[model samples]
Target: MFSLLPLGYVGVMTADAGWDTIEKLVFRPRVGELLFNTVALVVVTVPICVVLGIGGAWLVERTRLRAHKVWAVLLAAPLAIPAFVNSYAWVSAIPSLGGLFGGVLISVLSYFPLVYIPVAAVLSRMDPALEQSGSALGLGPWRVFFRVVLPQLRLAAAGGALLVSLHLLAEYGAFAMIAFDTFTTAIYDQFRSTFNGAAANMLASVLVLLCLLLLLGESKARGNARYARVGAGAQANPSRLALGGFQAPAQLGLAALSVLALGVPLFHVGRWLVAGGAEIWTRDALATSLLQTLGYGLAGALVTTILAFPLAFLVIRHPGPVSKLLEGANYISSSMPGIVVALALVTITIHYVPGVYQTAVVLVAAYALLFMPRALVNLRAGLAQAPRELDEAAQALGKPPLVAFFKVTLRLTAPAAAGGAALVFLGIVNELTATLLLAPNGTRTLATEFWTLSSEIDYTGAAPYALLMILLSAPMTYLLFAQSKKVAGQ
Candidate 1:
């Protein structure tokens, strides 16, 4: 059913002006420009994010850096501020920061944490023996990392880079604020200016194609190499590299990153809050938006997580071409921008389920489609850890398949499921584009509310919502850190 949304986009493309329209649009200079902008952002941003993420992770996890725990939390805390908000802070601070450079800067600050967390986790859990062996063989630290440690980080880094690419493709608000024209912003402009979804759908199709390419590349990059050891042994902590003279530089660099990513946004938000006065605190709309945001986030998380379970199970427990194809399809949709998903849903709902068009149900459905991959990734990881032997043992004890799953498999995987749900909830709370389009009449979330006031240049009015958004995301950000640490420790 979720896959049908992208199919609906394809149908819209052909139904109106047939292939000629698509060909003209696809061949247009504007399309080329959009593609370049989109591809350029991904190319530039992903590598920078990778360097920052991996570098930061190495410093925190592998070096004898002081206050490593504090640095880890600080690195991951940027997830509390959405990229769009970060863009607002930077552009507002320096009016000239409104182009590709600024867009790339803000996005890197916002998204490097995505790379940092997973790479850090993998680094922490890595076998000390590998590094020790490399050192014993007379390899230096750099060579050992490049040859041995970096190879093991390939899967995690690739996965994180894939996520960054998908996000750059799907991002609208941040790019829009910085006046960077990606396909996502182009589609949004078409929808808003002329209400011409055919053009938007055409652009969306190209965007989907880009996402498919990314998926394929990441799949090939991940390959089938297993990083886990075959035999069980007492796990030893990896030796920390002596930083010596680099410790100050490393700490200074991390502090600068945290300031850029987290401090600036909070600083700007605080400025607005103070300027906005007590009147900002007394607005009835503030409370309403908070409740609505929480409600939608919870609903979206539950629905997306529930929907992800079966797909994760299918691909993990019954791996094959068919299951892999199904999993890949979900990822393609997950890579789509919220506006694209919302437009596709609008097309389908209006044609076949007009009654639910513009309803909260359809809005939540869009959230589910956009965020299901997060849940699927975590669920699949959890299920992979849970050996089949446990399930079979339960079956041998006379428990039916369903009983065994709930009593054993599900119990074992609950932590992962919960973490995935938390991630989905955080995503839904921060989502802006789809909520703007598909939300029922009079509905508002923190994202939409913040965008509304910010668009109007009413920074004071928007301050409360922005602050609320960061506050709401704080707990989830901490949970994510804890979850990453738990996975690494295991």
Candidate 2:
């Protein structure tokens, strides 16, 4: 059903008015400009995100920096601030920061943590023996990293880059805030200003193509590389590099990154709060939006988590062509822009279930479809760790298969399941496009509300919602950091 969304998109493309729409939109210089802007942003931002993520991870995990733990948390904390919120902060602080440069800067700052967490986890769990071998062969630290450590980091880094690319492709709010014309923002504009969804759908088709190319590129980059160690001996802590004279510079760099990524948004939010100019912070609006955001977030998280379990179990336990295909389908569907999913649901619901059209049920379903992969990935990781042998062992102890699964596998995977649910919840809270389309009358999420007010140049009115969004996402940010540490055994 989730996969059907893309098929619906195909139907949209081939409908009666489709070819002419595609030809006109495709040949337009505006379409070419949007493509260039989108590709250029990804081309620049992905590399920057990779470097920052890997660099921050290495500094925190492999350096003798003071208060490494604090630094680690600080680096990961930016995940709480949405890219749109970051854009709002920068553009608000400096009104001229409203173009391609600002878009790239805000996106990189907002998303580098996606790279940092996975890379840091891999770094923490890596066998130090490899590094030791490199050192014994007379390789300097830089040479050892380039030859040994970096090869091991290839899979994680590539995976992070793919994620960054998908996000850049689907991102509408941030780029829209900065007046940068990307496919996503253009799609939203096409839908909003002219109600010309055919053109928007064509733009989305281009985005879908970009997403497919990225997935293929990442898979090729990953190749058949195996990162696990061969030795059976217990692993020991890796040695930290002495920063020496570079320590001050490293500290300053980290400080600047944190300020840019995290501090700026918070500072602007605080400023707005103190100025007391927000017209939308009334009791009814605030209470209603908060409840709606929480309600949708919780419902979406729960549904996505439930749906992900069986799929994760199938992929991890029964690794085969079918399982791999199913997993790939999930990835493709999840990578789709929210507008695509929203249009798909809108088409289906309005046609088949007219009573539920534009209802909260449809909106929550969109959230589940868009975010199920977040839950699936974490659940797969947890299931992989919980081994089938544990379930068999429980069965050997006279428990039934179902009972054993619940008693052993589910219990062991609980933390991962919770983490996945938390991630989905945060995603739902921050989701803008789908909510804008599917939310019934009188429903208002913080994301949609913020976008509405900010679009009207009412930054002060948007501040409370933005701050609430950050506060709501903060615990999940901490949860992600703690979970990564647990995975790395740090």
Candidate 3:
């Protein structure tokens, strides 16, 4: 983690002489605009995600949509395509799709499923007793939906929206290609071009502030629990609103949106694959990159998930200001972009522990730093669902705390833990910016390989790996959706 400290030390000592140049980066108009761009992207994207989430959940769970299971799988499959790769696909397909709208489109396509999966799970598990009670009282279907069902959706929506917002704020590679100016892009620009350490730090500090404000907003929206064991055994016949007049338009619109967002990019990849199969299918180098990427991603996910358990257990079992702070600190690293975290770690390592600089271990640690929050968030939610009474009952027996935890609590939380691990693994596999900065010399993950090829105007060469990554990420997404269903069930 301290892999970049010595570089920071050098930057600090040098800044003593060029303080004026560094001062130029301290929250200027450019920074403000970048900040606004980032916030606007989140603002635009989160609503889209939420709407898609709620609507998709309704369509699949309640409405008479055919092959709803297939739709569920399709919606979640987009998550398999990394944001940057999605950017590459879209930009290559339609050069005009660049800037704010492009960012929103890619993010919505990539992240709405985060919202959709959870809300759909919640919808699937929702008990219709209160809703029926509302109807029994003299309320219309819309009234029941707006007043009752919508209220129940707030927690799941908040959680999903929070994830979207954080991802937007911290996004890097996708933004780099899309001509969207955000703090993350600026920070990376500073690091790559001038190596302007102070400028990057200043931007990072602002990004962190933005994240805090977002956290506060999410906290407010994430209300206290209402009912715990809902839809466990109750008949969940959700009231499906009829779309008699609106059916064709609704289906057409959804189909068009999905095609435009997902289809065009895939079409471009197909073009490349058909045109340059022989050129891109060279065995040795591609295999090496794929293996390295898989190893690093799998290793990083395992380590991060293991590390997150203690923090999550503490926070859920012993909720307090201190515990919350520890959990928040864990997310802070994640809420910031990979480049920023990589820069900070680079500075720390370069100055304090030079030996670890640019090593694979340092790179894996960076992945853990950037992705542990994901593990913690899911695990904490899972832990909260574990009945406290079970622990008490276990203690009543002769089982030790550790033994009881492993035997009971951990067993109960395994699905959630596995779910979180799946998310982390997916993230590490798709991650780009930090991997580029921290990976050992000559070491190329699929992300780095794709970026390197794309940088050289070799998009054709990049397609195979991009396709492979999407394929690898597909099953992980399915597992996540399944786990979400499991969690919502509980």
Candidate 4:
């Protein structure tokens, strides 16, 4: 029920607005323009991200790329810098960077790693037998990769593409900074211009539908395919293909990616920090924002992890229609833009539960809903590691059912739970749209504070917050990459 609040909010808002009002708001030139911008952004960006992700992953994991280990980490390092920070850097460098092209450029640089990390994880664990058989059949390396290898990557690619699409939909700061208008940006504009206005709700309604379509598209793209070996002696390391003449090109591509994605943000942030000098660091608000950001990130992570455990356990321990239904609810809920989730909570609390409106509880709950999937995915994996047989054995050894579950199953999931919590922490710390909408008066997170200063064109003033946010996110980003490798049985 809680998970469905976002859908319900849109439904209720649309109903309240009536068909005429909704039509006026949604079926207009402005809405059409925003839709085109949003769709074009996804269509142009996701494929490039997929290509880059797969190629980069293949090079790092399956080919003789120089400093493969270093490249692996470097490719994923861009994720430590928030998308908006990347936008800030680009806009600072080239103020003319805007519109669809700029949106695509910044988004690809910032988000390709989303695709890379997962596809790389999948590639690292791929069975070389498929490729070997293809080679035996006289297929060249490129042919084997295209025909045999790439098909297997469909699931990962589809998932990564879905993530990229959703990020584009949810993103506001990046596009906003680049002067590109998407559904999220337009929705934010609507809300700011007219708080709880009919048009804003209607725009959110359309955005929600768009999200549902992407979900369905991803479902179709991802088909029901399982890749598990029936019996295995041991997993063998996939043989690395020598790059020969392709070496320099691959290295150059990766180097360029590193420079654009990781380099720009670091350089610009450092420059601003230097310009800001002692004035930025000495600001009391900087320390306050850091502490508040940590406080909120920690709180949100704890809440989300706790909330995710039951759903993950239910799906893992006892898979059934009910569990699947609940799981689907969560995935759909989490896939919605943070703006929609924040709007839903804002509407619900302001109209129904006035006491908690704009409180930390509301903000935390929003974080949990928006990031629960991170926790669920990890907890499900961890739960699978423990197995039902262990719980039965623990109970057989004279322990109560509940005690057995706690001592055995729950204990084993601790590390995964912590990892998921860390991801949730990362998400909340960098989140912008939702924080702007839902945070109470006087609340100041690093993301919110950075946004505040950056909005005023004070990139120098925003420098410390950007630097601190990157610093805070770096470890979590590395953890995310390392965890993916570990999960692939590296």
Candidate 5:
């Protein structure tokens, strides 16, 4: 319900502005241009990401690829570098980087992990029996793969595509750094000028419509297809396809991709660090930003994980229509762009709870809304592994339900919960749009500080924060990778 507050805010703003004003605001040429750029970015970037993501996953999981582990790690490593940071690296290297081409390149590098991670997991656990049956029926490998294998990937691919679309739509810093005028950047610009006036509100409404359309499209495409295996014995490891003479080309392609996606950003950040000199690492400023970022990440992760616990429990323990509806609502709310979530929180607190306006509490609330899905995913995975029989057995032993939950179920789930928190921490450390708008006075996170220095073209000064963010995110990314494998039943 809290997640829907942003929708309410948009609705109220639209009603206040009325139909004529909305028609005027939404129908302008500049608005049309922004929409084109934004939609074109999604249209061009997602399929490429999907192809690259699925291809990378297939190479690592289903082929006799050399250094599969190394390739897997390298492919997923781009997630550690935020999109805006990726854009900064590209622009630093090629000063003329801007527009749709530039936006697609940087975004693809940063977000393909969204598709790659899940698709890789799906590829990893697929039962060999299905493919074997297809082969026995006189099907060629490509036919079996397309007919038998790829269909199972529909859910994961669609979900990944939806995430990528949302990221592209909500993105501000990455696009803004390159002067790509999406609705998000335009709304931010309007807010700078008018401070949440009709123009910004109207742009946000259009963006909300785009988000809903993507959600609905994904749902429709996903439609009630059953992929679960029945009459299953123990699942067998999928057979690896022989690359034969094509091996060299496959290896070369992945190597080139790594160079473009992961190598460029790391090399430029290192170059800046070298140029910055030892003195550019201001001890006081760096430490404060580092500590504050840590504090915010920890606090927000804790709150989000706690909130996700009961919801995760409900959905896992009781899989009914009510649970599904509640879970869906949570997901739909979390799908809202961070900028809209932040904007809503800012407006809500100022008008309804003025004392808490710009407070750390509100900032944390924004993080909770924006990131609750991450925590929920991990918690649900954890809870699924823990059977309710154990809880009932504890109750049979005379312990109260709450105590049994804390001592037994909670202990069993702690690692996964911690894993979820770590993912949330990684997100908070790199988050820019919401933190930029919602952070309280005198607050400076690593992301915000990095953006500030980089905005002034102090590339050298920004290097440390980027390095720190990547370093901090590395372990969490590994955790996520490991978790994917585990959950995929590999």
Candidate 6:
């Protein structure tokens, strides 16, 4: 427990000192508007995500959609583009498409994959024979879909929706571009301009409650059976429905959406690259920002991975209230917006210790706090598969607890652990809000650099940094997909 002392001291002391600001900011009308905006984004985005996800999954996995395998890859391609990158592209492409609608479009495009991937996995694994039997028993096609397919999709849909909601909650860049003020943006403004830590913590508390509600709603939707049978192998047969007349329109719709969502953004980036040429790299700020981003990314990824191990073990092995609380605590940081968390930490840091202000360590710690859940969920899945008997066997072989864990359990869980670490790394690299606030005065990350350049209407000049960020992230995306494939044994 004392191992956690340093962290507590830093967080607690700063938080206490920041109370006055937190109290005043908590009741601001802007905070209310920000809260509303946050809720609205999630509310609007969730349905679109579900519809696209469920529809795409059903079309590719269960129907005779034209070029099924091709469609599958295309649909999942959106996951490669970072949310903020997509926002930057869309906002730059059509200045008219700004604010709430613009935010919605960017978010839906970037995150629908979150819904599509999991729901599609569920659909792929479902026993389609049941649907066939329903049809054989005189149940109409509509009846079969509503009664048979929908129920099976509930848990997956819930999980995916939860992820989408959380992403929306924490979103910064996209919403920021569109002029949609949410708790995250507001918190960032407060910290950067006002340096009010207390106000930030109070807002963070509210955001945390909102996230808890979302989590509960997700759990209630998932229920016991769906959560329990997440990765179980059940015999299933591919049931493909012929598109016939619908094929042409379906193909066109999918293609058009893909182009609008993905193609346009890449085109915008290219245009910037062509226009700016050498001006983008001439700035010293770009180099500083890139270095900052790399440092934060490395530290956040390592720390999150380390912290995730014991938490994953507890959830996977213990599976009780205590474990649930631990897991839930991890979830809070992710679900609440990054600015809110940063502000909370800022308050804690300023009031308590005041020693670590604007340090690289605080910024990295904020990243870990925000993205640790990714590691937790991924590692927990892999850990659950490791049988209890293996531990006993390792012990019987004269291995100590730590040695047995490393030689046996850790080795077996390596792929999942690595996948989780990659996710944390990717998230940290792309992270903006906490990086913006807690980052040292001279430090600038790729995200901050992109923002700074863009803010000054130097869109062309920002292109290189934006493109670099994407390039760095692309490999991470590939790793995520590759790991998923391995997990799926595909």
**Strongest candidate by lDDT:** 4
Per-residue lDDT tens digits for candidate 6, residues 1-490, read 3123223433564466576756576667877787878888889999999999998888888778878888877787777777877877887778877767877888899999888887777677676566887899999877988888888888778888998998888787777777778776665665666576456545556666677799889988877774224444456576687888989988998898789777987899999989988776788877777777777787788888888898898888788998887676666556666766676567667877699977877887777777887788789878877866798799998999888988888888887887898899888888877777787887778888888887777889878888888888877876665555455443
Clashes of each: 0, 0, 17, 0, 0, 17
Look at candidate 1 and give me any clashing residue pairs: none
Query: How many angstroms is residue 242 displaced in model 2 relative to the true structure, after the best TM-score fit?
Result: 1.0
lDDT of 3 at 249: 72
Tell me which residue pairs clash in candidate 5.
Answer: none
Q: How does model 3 score by TM-score?
A: 0.88
lDDT of 2 by residue, 238-298 (tens): 8999999989999999999999998899999888877755454774787889998999999
State candidate 4's TM-score: 0.98
Judged by lDDT against the true structure, how good is candidate 3?
0.80
Position 5, candidate 1: lDDT: 69
Q: Estimate each model's TM-score.
A: 0.94, 0.94, 0.88, 0.98, 0.98, 0.88
Q: What's the lDDT for residue 24 in model 6? A: 72
Candidate 1's C-alpha runs over 4 A off are 11-16, 316-319, 381-406, 488-490
Per-residue lDDT for 5-118 in model 5, tens only?
888888888889988998999999999998999999999999999999988998999999999999999888888888999998999999999989999999999999899998
Predicted candidate 1 versus true structure: per-residue lDDT over 185-274, tens digit per residue: 999999887674567778878887888899899999999998886565447788999998998989899989998998889999899899
What is the lDDT of every predicted structure here? 0.87, 0.87, 0.80, 0.92, 0.90, 0.77
Model 3 ranges with Cα > 4 A deviation? 1-23, 223-233, 316-322, 377-416
Please tell me which model should have the higher TM-score, number 2 or number 6. 2
RMSD of 6: 3.7
| Candidate 5 lowest-lDDT run of ten | 227-236
- Candidate 2: list runs displaced more than 4 Å: 15-20, 231-234, 277-282, 385-401, 488-490
Better of 2 and 4 by lDDT: 4
Count residue pairs with overlapping backbones in model 5. Answer: 0
